[model samples]
Target: MIAVALVTGTLLFSPVLATHQVEVRGTAVLSTEEVIEAAQVPLGVPLTRLPRATISERISALAPVADVRFGQSLPHTLIITVTERTMVYQVADRGSFHWVDGEGVDFHQTAEQADGLLGVLDISNERLLRDVATVVTSLGPEVVTMTTKVTADSIDHIVLTLSDGRQINWGSAEKSAEKAAVLPTLLGMKAAWIDVSVPSHPAIK
Candidate 1:
């Protein structure tokens, strides 16, 4: 068999045998349908002709897909596997809610109800929202569990609403670990809001 590279940055396969056989496969953390569709592979085509690198790039375009592996499965079969990131919070737009990954790329099916997921809103800055999403992803599960909504202000601060109707003051993405460390203790106290913006002294009011 002879393989030729195309100027369009794709691969081309010429049959050198009585039968042309190829297999491809990959794993997707959440779903593989999107990955296969993005590859734009025809129903009947040689596997070698498919651009593996280009296909991987297309799969990576998806927000949830963290890592994608593409390879041949057996004969005349293409397979794709994708690893998705964890869901930190669900951001709502208009009436639909979409799941935001750690990278703040919004994807996934929309939900009508808020459910147990935290809601992020009123973000004045895109960078801050992205940083907050990263912080939410890094914090322990309890942080996610306790948080209901995250609102961003011009002061580069985050205002969080807990499930218990208690508000929290999170200064910024910096020192999120330290703030998270005092979460259990703070939740134990009785107050309408907890201010953890100051690393040294976190107050409740």
Candidate 2:
């Protein structure tokens, strides 16, 4: 009976463990105020009873959020950690562009161009979009730094344009990992065009 009463009082009546503040971290494109408002964290509630699952669900509903985690500090604080999506490329529509992540999700739209990320021009189908995204995501920093744009008429004919006006014919998304692994070294060779369509027998001319 003593233990039960202690538990009940600590959980329900204790002011020391009550939520006094909410702290949000790991946000890049989102504002701290935005996450706090969505969480709707009840003030003065006991830390253990903060409805974390529901709060997580609400925050996850935000388009930029890829994942969210919750925790509580012993005295009087609630902690929310978020993992935002990694935007890989941009696709133009009228005057604006949609920011697409590695998973091919169009999460954000803006009129200004994103620096360092490649722009995709001719990808027409959803399947091709995902395929090209996978290929672009697999590429190393060296390759991406050199690349200016990506284009695909079909899923099987993905292409990357270099800053120096060179092309890399990345046939399909099938062997992307292998192709990416070999690209840094391949770019150093004297070649007219590079093809990693078949990574095992890559053609460079």
Candidate 3:
């Protein structure tokens, strides 16, 4: 009992286990300095006294942060691993748009258009927004590169417009992988419209 109490007291009070360095990892668009600034971890504070939950909340408030995890590296370091959000497509909102990730999280907002991502137009509510995100993000690289815009009047009426002014009737978010797999072959044809809502039997016009 005495030994355990001594060890606990030493960890809580001594500078030997205090954090002197913060190591940031797994960042893409976020800089290490910005992550450190957001963490606000007090230097020379005992690791046992660290407010991990508060630190996580602060770092997560950053627009690009999807998830954050912390670890104590013994002696003098606090390690933070950050997972940044991926901008799958842009959802239009008047003059600007919000960026959505694969799981349908709207994480960032910007007025300027981004490269290599489709712009979603005519989106109404959160449900349809998530549905559109699912359909577009499930597409293979070949189909995604050719797509310029995605629009959905209703969940069942999702459509994709290619760069060459042609259209693809994507139906719903169901069977997205199959639909994406079949689009490249269908794109070779000079059809004005291609329907892969049911990939087993496609339609063209």
Candidate 4:
């Protein structure tokens, strides 16, 4: 009876543990004010009673947030951590370019092109964009530095153009991890083209 009473007392009267401040971290593209606005954190609510999942869901609804986590600091503080999506490719539309993340989400648009970002030509299909992003992101840093552009007529017809005018027939997004693993060795050879479409039996010319 005494334990139950003590628990009830804590739940009912813990004003000192009520949330009074919110701190946001791990943000790069998003401002702390934007995250705080999106989170809609309930100030004055007891930290123990705050709906963590609900807060996370609200923050995740923001376009740039790829992932989010929530925590409570003792007494009166709420902590929010966020992981923003990275721009992997850019699609040109009517002379303007939009940034796309690895998940194929076009989250931002700009008139100026970013250095080292690959351009996606003519393809607007989201699935194809995702496939292109997958292949581009899976490549080793060395291979990525050599890549200049990615293009596709269809989902299965993905191609990568290297800085030295070499071409890579990446096939579909399937088996990308395997292809990425083997591509570096193939690039070392004196070949104008490399096809890792079928990673197990890659071809070079």
Please, what is the TM-score per model?
0.74, 0.85, 0.80, 0.84
Report the lDDT tens digits of candidate 2 across residue range 1-205.
9999999777676887889999999998889999999889998988887888999999998889999998877789999999998889988877887788898877777788877565565534668768878998899887888898888777788889998988999998998999998887889998869999999988888
Model 3 vs truth, CA RMSD: 3.2
What C-alpha lDDT does candidate 3 achieve relative to the native structure?
0.86
> Candidate 2 or 4, higher TM-score?
2
| Residue 34 Cα positional deviation in candidate 2, in Å, after optimal superposition | 2.0
* Model 4: per-residue Cα lDDT over 1-205, one tens digit each: 9999998788645897889999999997789999999889889989878888988999998888999988868879899999998888888878788788988887767788876656665646778878888888898888888888888777788889999999999988899999999898998999999999999999999
Which residue ranges in model 1 land beyond 4 Å of their true spot?
1-33, 42-49, 109-111, 122-125
What RMSD value applies to candidate 4?
2.7
Which pairs of residues collide in candidate 3? none
**Alpha carbon lDDT at 135, candidate 1:** 63
The lDDT values for all models are 0.66, 0.85, 0.86, 0.86
Q: Which regions of candidate 4 deviate over 4 angstroms? A: 1-8, 121-124
10 residues in a row with least lDDT, candidate 3 = 116-125
Better candidate number, 1 or 3, judged by lDDT? 3
> Model 2 residue 58 lDDT?
95
TM-score of 2: 0.85
